[model samples]
Target chain A: MDLFGQYVVNGLMLGTVYALVAVGFTLFFGVLDVIKFSHGDVLMVGAFTGFTAASGAAALGFSHPLAQLAATVVFALAGTAALGAAIARWLILPLKSAPRLNILLATLMLGTALRESVRLFYPDGSNPKAFPALLPTSSWQWGQFTLRADSSILVVTGVLVIVGLHLLINRTRLGLAIRAVAQDEETARTMGINYTLIVLVTFALGSSIAAVAGVMNGLYYNEINFGMGLLLGLIGFSAAIIGGLGNLYGAILGGFLFAALQMIGAVAMPFASAYKDVFAFAVVIALMAWKPTGLIPERASDRV
Target chain B: MDAAIEISGLHAAYDKADVLIDVSLTVAPGTITCLLGSNGAGKTTLIRAILGLTPPRAGSVKVFGAEVTGEATHRVIARGVACIPEGRRMFPKLTVAENLRLGAYQEPSEAEIKRRLAEVYDTFPRLAERRNQLAGTMSGGEQAMVSIGRGLMGKPRLLIVDEPSLGLSPLYVKENFRIIEGIRARGITVFLVEQNVHQTLAIADAGYVLSGGRVVAGGTAAELKSNAEFHAAYFG
Candidate 1:
């Protein structure tokens, strides 16, 4: 496979991961107006859950690929959703009436606590543990191009998840309530929407989807660790801000654009690879400087 | 058979500052009761208290003979009261039709919803003309019409309108008042809050002048209009 074609493929796979991770960030923020800093930690927890489940099942003599993958993904998603619900109910709810800065700080503390707790509990605090390889570690070459099946699945599933979220936001009654609450909480409550329930549902649903991305990351990379979420969470957040926080499609586009820039930067100039974080942060800062509202900022509704 | 809305000694405050003090009023069924006041005379406060947006510190608010004090705004709405709140709060991102549909969120059947929607369109044909346009993109008067139409789609038994003529051209203001009268003509009781005293009194069955968060003067529209004190206080 040509290097250029490889970069494109790799970029796409990476973009899919970032997009999936960023989806929750945007969804949660748009609905509740607070960035959930612990979202990526929740994703890391999901990856660990999948890692243990798949490995334990394999050790118990279960060899069927489909069953193992399904079980791992479902368990991870359910576990992450439960955790998200608890956070939304207990930690987030009390601070709903508080200032925006307080919520942000609280989530930051929670994320740090979770990351540290995981490191302490795991036997090897700083070492990467082997994640069970659910997919065969083989690649298929198509004349000048190569694709890994797992990478393809990651991209496809991520795309499907985003499309499904779009449909949920635009077509369903729940979507209407969500959009209404995002626009005006007091008015939505006056319109008979249970704003608290909607917030909790959005948090749980977004986090569960993040869990899917988490499991995929573990499976593809074949390694997992406690702090895997911190860097990735920052990148995902940058993508979300670039895309315009409340807009779903914009976030997806931003993710892909981010990945493409990173890949092209790495290949075109070897020096850029070492400073990819610097480049990504620069891009985000540049975007904010140029268009402070975002690439697709929300329009003010007539309702206050 | 009963008063559409009844408030007695409605005392409310914002934080520690008293905004509404011993405010009391009632609107008869199928009639318009106009609350005429200047900007800070507590008209909006009274409306907000009635909708339970700001719970009254002391007193009672009864809508359709049911005490709705301390109820959430939407709950008050579900009990057959709707408010065209200050600023005509229409969902700007939605189409005029979508905004109307959301107004019928609590309606039981699609058919009933459709019927109500059609009635709204008939009443505000301008909204029908711009049904597919984004509500925010419309002119202010057009958006106000959509806002009022959306309120009507809820099939409200009593509608409390806060400053319906606000921010409108004089012609739109006249037309807007006519629309409120039209809603009243359909046998829906209206509790009208307005700064446009003369125009509101022209169509009102009865009127109250609010001062320092109290009903300083109230009577039949003509009686209030003819009274020297009211005329000097409001007009002079």
Candidate 2:
């Protein structure tokens, strides 16, 4: 019973991060009508930025860890958002009317460039560096289970981010514009909405959200690496697709489900530990084949 | 009063195929101007050109005397030109309220937007009843109503409607034309494109008969209705 509870808690913690990442993927896909393949690497870059900023700031005699972490997240989000806008403006904009395949390849190349550049530039080529932990390492007893403060922080912060994002999308004028553009770009334009500005803002929103997930992952795992984003991004994207792309609630639901599956797979058959990636992929494929539109498919009329 | 819309020597093409060739027309304010033609007769292309969705290769399009030959779609729209585009391009996934709000995207104030929304719902009581309903799930006639209502929310000086009666039942067709007539009654100028010649001619203050990208005949609705050329082109 204790083991089961712990697994559930673990799954929930992992799910929240996945939700953040998946939301970014779903958001970009919703507005642009193109899968931004480089989204994951951008996340990895965000994590590195946070990690470097925090570590550098700490070395510069900033004793307060929480403040450093907060500053790191803010700077990382701003930096990654700029990078996202650049990607949209420079690489994706020219190929807007081109074939989907070309854009996919271009994004893929950009992801590769981002990942390889990080690895080459970092002191350790392939090895992971120790990511600084900001939250208290203390644990609390809940019935028969031991819950770490760090995991609790992760879960709370994740929920806040998701809720905040939900409000941003549903309530704000900018969100309405994004929804409008998503529905019909031409109609949106005819309504006096600027296409270029909307696209830039959308990219920035997605990238910054992805940065939040990246920072959380760095804090939770206490390690950072260039290749980290690719795995996390794939899983997050899978969750988004499974939940239904463009549906924000669906992404979060898909994230939790995905995390639960991973924990269950790891526990049910210890041998499955090595094949976790295989299991996740199989689940995504099966879900797609069974319900091609996704678990909570977005209505067709919302199409741009 | 300024001309609602004036296009001088307008030339436009769609992907290497010339759709509008040196077409020129001026819509008088506070009247309905109908562009009557059969399918593929460049009616939609003309609307698209005027809206700046497709740039004219030659000539000028002026909305209320403001020359907007190569302006962007948004700029054209900002100049008080609203289009109920062909096929009633309503955002399907959005609720009626959501769709209505989008219509007033350019409006500066929330209070003003809310007032306009109330005005829209008041005009289209059916839409008001289904404010929270998804737009795609609505009937074709209802969707058409929402589309027109959305355009009205923009408070455009010139309302361009393309094929509002397309794919609608006869009863709905009458209702749609009545709505346009109501807009005209309210002193909003209309540039209407339609294949339903008899009814469109009946409501129009003046009519332009377009065939093969040229205005073959132009006169008061009564005059066009009596023309042998109009009858030969459409009725024959």
Candidate 3:
């Protein structure tokens, strides 16, 4: 029982990170019909930004763990938000009239460019860099069910952020504008909603969330690498697709589902635990083939 | 008379194909001006050009006497023009209230938005009852109400309604025209585009007929109603 509980906790923690990344994909897909293939690299950029911020803060004598964490998060989110908006405006918007495949390939190439730039520019970035331990190294035990203090903190923060996002999307005027634009771009424009501004804001918001996920990932794993975003991005995109592309709740659900599948695969086939992705992906393919719209298909009709 | 919207010598195209050529029209403040045409006569194109969705190749489009020929759609809307597009394009997945709230996207204050919401609700009690319902779930007549209510939420000085009667039953078509008349009664200038000639002319102050990308006829509604060419072009 305790072993099962431990796996569950681990899966949930990992799922939170996936959820954050998946939500970004869902949001981008909601506003723009295009999937941002470069999103995973954006998250990587965010992790690197946080890493640099943490190092700079430590060098400046802001040695307290909380202070370092705060600085890391703030700088990373802001930097990633700006980068996301720039990519959307300069990279995505200009290709509005181009063939859809062209945009997809362009974003794919942009992701490659970002990954290479980080690897080439940052000193020894191709090598994994040790992440700073900003989280408290403590654990709480309850009758063989142990929880690491840092993991607990991350879990609680992730839940709060997700809840906050739900409110921002459902209860705010900006959210209303976003939904309007998502539903019908031309009508939203005629209703006086600035299309460009909304698209930029959506990109910024999604990237900022990915930044938080990136920092949390580094803190949890204690290491960061330039190529880390590739697999993580693929996993996040897969999660979004399985959850139902463009559906916010579906993204989070898909994240947890993917994590659970991985955990189940690990426990059920201990000898081949490394092939968890293969198992999860096989199940996802079956699910997709069975119900292609996903678990919670988008409510909007496909008819134009 | 003050012009709410004025277009002169306008030329517009979609890609390489020209749709509007040397088109000139004026919508007087507080009057319903109808643009009548058959299918493929560039009526929708003309509306798109006026809203800045399609930029005119040559000519001036002035709203309240200010030149706004090539402004972005949202910017033009911010200058107090709202379009109830053809087919009553409501965000089907969104609630009736959400659709209405988006109409006031430029209104900065919550109080103003609330006031507009109340006003729209009062105007269309059917929409008020179904405010929380998804627009797609609503009946066609109800959807039209939500669309018109959304357009009213902007408190626009000039409301451009493109085919308000499309896909509606005869009773709903009458109701739609009545609502358009009410909008004109509220002192809002209306630019109506439609192929339903008789019903549109019944309520319009002035009318223009377009054919082959050109304004072939223009007169007061009564004059167009009496003219043999207009009658033959439309009814025959």
- Give DockQ per model, in order: 0.33, 0.58, 0.64
* Candidate 3 residue lDDT tens string, B134-196: 899999999999989999989999999999999999999998999899999998999999989
| A95-195 per-residue lDDT for model 1 (tens digits) | 98899999999999999998998899866756788887777657898887777777777778878888888788887778877777777776666566667
lDDT of 1 by residue, B1-236 (tens): 77899899989888988888887888999989999888898888898788877788999999999999998776788888877878888777777887787777777688998899889888788888889888778999888888788778888898889999999999999998898999999889999999998899999999788877878888889998887777666665
Model 3 chain A: weakest 10-residue lDDT segment is A295-304
Q: Which regions of candidate 3 are displaced past 4 Å?
A: A300-304
| lDDT by residue (tens digit), candidate 3, A54-102 | 9999999999988999999999999999999999999999997788788
- CAPRI verdict (incorrect, acceptable, medium, high) for model 2: medium
Better of 2 and 3 by DockQ: 3
Each candidate's interface RMSD (Å, one decimal) is 3.7, 2.2, 3.0
lDDT of 2 by residue, A90-169 (tens): 99888999998899899999999999999998767578978888889999987888888988888898899899878877
Q: What is the interface RMSD of candidate 1, in Å?
A: 3.7
